[model samples]
Target chain A: MTKKVATREAYGRALAELGKKNSAVVVLDADLSKSTKTADFAKVFPDRFFNMGVAEQNLMGTAAGLAAAGKIAFASTFAVFAAGRAFDQIRNSVAYNRLNVKIAATHAGITVGEDGGSHQAIEDIALMRSLPNMTVFVPADEAETAGAVEAAAQMNGPVYIRLGRAGVPPIHGEGFRFETGKAVVVREGRDAAVIATGIMVTVALEAAVTLAKEGIEVRIISMHTIKPLDVKTIVSAARETGALVTAEEHSVIGGLGGAVSEAVCENHPVPLKRLGIQDEFGESGKPDELLVKFGLTAAAIAGAVREVVKRKG
Target chain B: MENSEKELAVLKAAANEIRQDIIRMLGTAGSGHPGGSLSAADIVTALYFKFLRIDPENPKNPDRDRFILSKGHAAPVLYSALAQRGYFKREELLTLRKLGSRLQGHPDMKKLPGVDMSTGSLGQGLSAANGMALAGRLDSKDYRVYVLLGDGETQEGQVWEAAMASAHYRLDNLTAFLDHNRLQIDGPIEEVMSPEPLADKWRAFGWDVQVIDGHDMNQILQAVERALTVKGKPQMIVAETVKGKGVSFMENQAGWHGSTPNQEQTEKALAELLANKL
Candidate 1:
């Protein structure tokens, strides 16, 4: 049953539950309600769910206004539109004011597949993290995405929850807790640390399992919250492991790699190799092909870890 | 209460106080947008004093109306309105933009008392306003949401996006004021980017529209009152105003959009503002 649930569907379910609990919780979408899976919210709370059409900027601004009116607004759109098209609105209207607006941007990173680079948001985390008060999150799977949606509802201020378009595996357990700014160590190893976020967390876990067969123990940590990052977990992981590899479905320039580097720079600097899209626009393809092309597959994670461990040796 | 008579007196007094505060605050800051601030002062004054149901004493009160300054560079106007409405002490206005001052260069809702949303970047405020209005409808609350936009700010694509959404949602509880001062930081709005046929644009978007003199307290108040009577449609009040409404030499001057008044100019502006005993 869980195998078929896309993170987008989980988001819809979570939003319905959130709307039930909090009367102040309102959903706004930029005409991607069905695609982003916010249609359930619209059906359940017709008055509360607003389809702002293809206007990402208005969706952000309207969310900001709702927040000011004392509502926790979750504005939904494609990650590219939420982060790229409406960057200023999210920055000024929402984050700058510290308005309680959750940006649940779907189709994040290369997972957007055939829609191509224009729709795939590869640098959302970097863009959001750069904003002072913006809290960035990238959930790994459907269960984790559900937890993230619930968590974002409870948390104040602006939160960017990046979800993918494709049907991701239900990797996290039912009772798994998703806390803000905390890293979830999915698998433990000793030879190298594979710190990953969003959909890449699954790849990191796979890489660890594959590497374990080769007698190379790789630890996988789902660093979901990219901003206000889980430094303690990362620092200890680096210190204990001696080598590290950062993986994300975002740009190598500034997403998870940049965040992990900042943490390592402050505490324990180690031999680190970053695996992500290397600062280039993605092209139309199947999800798997895109992931492989962008070097965001389990193979890439394993290669990065092996390379980093080799450098350490 | 004679709504117009009461509103006129209130607007007359509040507008003067706001103007005085803008001049003094900008003069003291030595860096601020006085021209735009002055242009927005009267509209903000009328809204705070007459139109909106807001209590400054309990600013975060659930039922109170919300106002967002999308053109946030004009913080002095908003600060003055919030202060004059008893959100904070008038003395705080003097410390405008100073270090440790609650008032920053732009409105920061987290720091200030009555600020509905933080806005500085153009084209974001209307979206925030849409959020509030939608929230109000969701919560079964009738509290209206208001936003102020600069004429030049209308050129931003986001503003149009917000307009369409507001109308589609039939957000009758939302009212937006466009300070159609026809001037921006660089020069006149027409020269910068003509936002002309503004009313037609809003009308085409399905919003109930009104064009009025923004500085005229009676007209401003009337437009706001008329917005309430319109059912199932949002209202856009396009207020034709000078870049700087009060004070000689500054009115209609594009340079004053962001330039702080010199000490001598401050003294002169203050004198002009106080001559009417604001």
Candidate 2:
């Protein structure tokens, strides 16, 4: 049996470790410390932790202030509130100034489950990627989430990390290294390539395995960093595999699909199919039920790969 | 901590010069906020020249007191102060709002020297100041954090949120000044959106509130002293001021809130300021 850990849980443990190593690290939460998993950091470094009490705007601005004062501030809240509610504060105070603030937003995408569309943030990647100096990351699982947090701490500008509420299967092992703007190829194939991020990466891997049984080999690339995208790897995959399928747990409009399409269309135009929630809101259901309903399952990705391979001449 | 009569006269003269600089820069840029800039001239003057322990040569000193122009539309006032304090050449003040100028339309801390934070959007400066204050406490540093806010800007809900946090953290080292010019871009604040019973509001938010004449250098200096002696809570100095102060035609007028002065109007404003020399 494979071990499963929520990305947010990894974020909490990673932040506490960061706090221990770097005294300049401080954490802020907008009344969602327990859910966002920042409570772990709060327990260890009580003096360095600030509970901003349901004020997302103040949380972002205060984090920017702390960053300006030479402390690396990691502010956490639900993706909906952090990206939707306090966008202006993040844009003006953090990104525009290029402050060293990291916004670690958890409960991203349709995987938020039971909370429904109002709570899930399908457009967070779009909103964050549109900013001038923001670095966007959507880690695959627990290990990558930990690596991303440490990487954000070492970086010198604003970063937006999208985290999930559901536990994902750990893809990388104990010695896995993470680098920003670099995509890791989990599997190699020839017929087609599936570029995915977040929870969808593991799903893409399963789809590749399923496709391999049918004599259709597919490459699985985990394009974690959304902004400052690994265009080299994406373009290379487009060249190696004649067809491409992009998957994410977010809206198909401007998430991983849009990013891959933008790169491939300009550099190496290939037959492509995007897999995710089509431009619509998600409903209240179990996480698995939502994934199936939104066509985000492994079978759905395999179906996208088949269609794209057929369109490849 | 009182200033002598001679010192007061000098500070007043410097403030008048800053007011002239505001007009000159606005006239050169051909567009900028004048009303709030003019109103905040005296307060900024008192801070840069008298109170703040800042050295232009060492702008990023860790121990230096920090100032945030939360009401950032009044960038001209801050620019004039920075220039006068030798952060840059005083002649560079005229390059404000121009292409590729460090003196952006709003304060850009990354672009300009001696600026504590880049703040164009309203209601954010106070929170940034709170962070600085908290950092000071964490490091056991004695540097104070000062932020100036627009009276109209308090209409933003985030200001109250920051107010609550500052009090919750017991940030006694942070002091905020609300430039109560009573006017915004549209019209009078009372008619637009009332933040009235303002003193009680700050006091209720757990801040040591003080009301003073914003244009009075003596009163402004005295409030700073009083704020330092207070403990266990943050400070909010509510300063009553005219929208467009000093210039005869512009004073108390909302029309000058964001409009720039024409060349003739600029000459008249400068002459009016020059006439009030010590």
Candidate 3:
């Protein structure tokens, strides 16, 4: 059974908790407080939060300054603005310096339904992961997201946490340790492994159930940290299961699929099929409608898994 | 006046040693940016030895004042200061730019202890510094944040965006030093891009701006102290300097921007820098 929780709400709760424990933890947002779910944290700890209008670059720069001053800063904004508008600042200021700045980018992927492709941040994982000293996290659901947030507060360097705006199925529970370079095997299987990240983890689990009914054993691995990738788990999974299928709510190119492929190729080569957006722009639609239109559903994962199995033969 | 005279002599000696380290490290690596490193040596020396309350033995000390080299290509100067301050062995300076060496051409915070921010690309350091400053205010920490900017880097629009934000936030704890050497990798800054009336521009942006000779120890220290005195506004010390300052052959030469001095040039440059010690 897939647990369901909202990632945005989890972020707010986790941040409020972090604020209480770590006095050095400060939060900054760029206008969209309620939507990004930082408003709750603001209301609880008003003194630590700063609403920096819509200037994402300024938000990033200020976060860097805060980090330099021995404060752990969590700069919140929509994924698109935080990753796209402030790429250079994030790269040069925060990443380059290796400051202890946390970039909480909400509204990631096609899950950002009605707002359309402009607000959706599908490329953020790749943009952030490519930088040096950047620890990238895309939690599977609310519980995992909360754990990742707390872990980021503890990590002594820069972290970029991708949070989805819409509600997601809960994947982890309390007491589940979210290690930076470890992947969680959500389900044990044998014939094929369905490696998934972010919101797609639940969809992959659903796909595994359907595949199991068809007598095809499916292994579901939740790959949360994109950079400092869980190469050991991925390589072991690839070696154990001759076929590999990667699913993500991001561009197929430089995302989870690419990361998995890089690990597999370098270690254990296997018949692989990547399940993600096939280099296409997301359009404005309902969240469910967009997931279907973009082939990011459980059906798509099942299809890709079947295809990889066939290719293995 | 006596105290000022004593501090000036120490600063001058420290600056000369930093410059000597920069040349020696670059000459050893055979591939490092000598120009900007040389130009920023005095400022880097003064910041580490004089201004910043850093414990070389305990670099990760929470209360320590932060200093970030925004123009990170000048890693030699930063590395020199860090090594001299005993953050690491001075012998490690020779490993600059070598494969597997911690002393990369650009500062890497992971490898080095004292480097507050890793920098190489232009116009991004200020934002990180802004983040640090904002964090300080939130935590009510007394530690100040300092950043050094290249004049050529000011041409990057992000610098202006950061400047506007620093003022708006009233980040009084932040101080930015601009190495206004008036030159860049491509010819002169005037020819490549105009950042003229730099001090006035910063003032208009709501910062406490000061222009001084970057190589002058007293002026640099005075500007830094003045920045600390002013409250409710960020400070910009636009220090005019000569690229490749201490080395006569490399001074003011655009070709030295990213070029490694050859074996012969390295020897000559080292000799010139050593001569200035007397």
Report the lDDT tens digits of candidate 1 across residue range B1-278: 13557658867987998898889888888898988888888889888887789887788887888888999999999988888778888889988878998998999988998987888888888877877787778778878889899999999888888888889889999899999888888898888889889999999999999999988888887888888899999999999898888888898889888898889998998888889753
Clashing pairs in 2: none
Comparing 1 and 2 on lDDT, the stronger one: 2
Candidate 3: TM-score of chain A is 0.98
Best by lDDT: 2
lDDT of each residue in A240-294, candidate 1, tens digit only? 9989999888898889999899889889989998889898998899999988888
Which order, best to worst by DockQ? 2, 1, 3
For each candidate, what's the DockQ?
0.78, 0.88, 0.52
Fnat scores for every prediction:
0.98, 0.80, 0.89
**Which lDDT tens digits does candidate 3 get at residues A1-313?**
5645678778988998888888878899999999888898899888888888777887888787777667788999989899999998888778877888999998889888998888788788889989999999988887788789988999988999999887777676566888887899999998899999988898999899999999999999999989899999998898898899999889988989999999999999999998888888888999999999999899998998898888888
Flag the better candidate by DockQ, 2 or 3.
2
How much lDDT does candidate 2 score?
Answer: 0.94
Root-mean-square deviation per candidate:
2.3, 0.8, 3.7
The residue-by-residue lDDT of candidate 2 on A26-129, one tens digit each, is: 99999999999999999999999999999999999999999999999999999999999999999999999999999999999988999999998999998999
Distance from true location, Cα of A238 in model 3, Å? 5.8
For model 3, the stretches where C-alpha displacement exceeds 4 angstroms are: A1-5, A52-58, A61-65, A68-70, A85-99, A129-134, A171-193, A205-221, A225-244, A262-271, A305-313, B1-3, B82-92, B99-102, B246-248, B260-278
Interface alpha-carbon RMSD, every candidate: 1.3, 0.5, 2.3
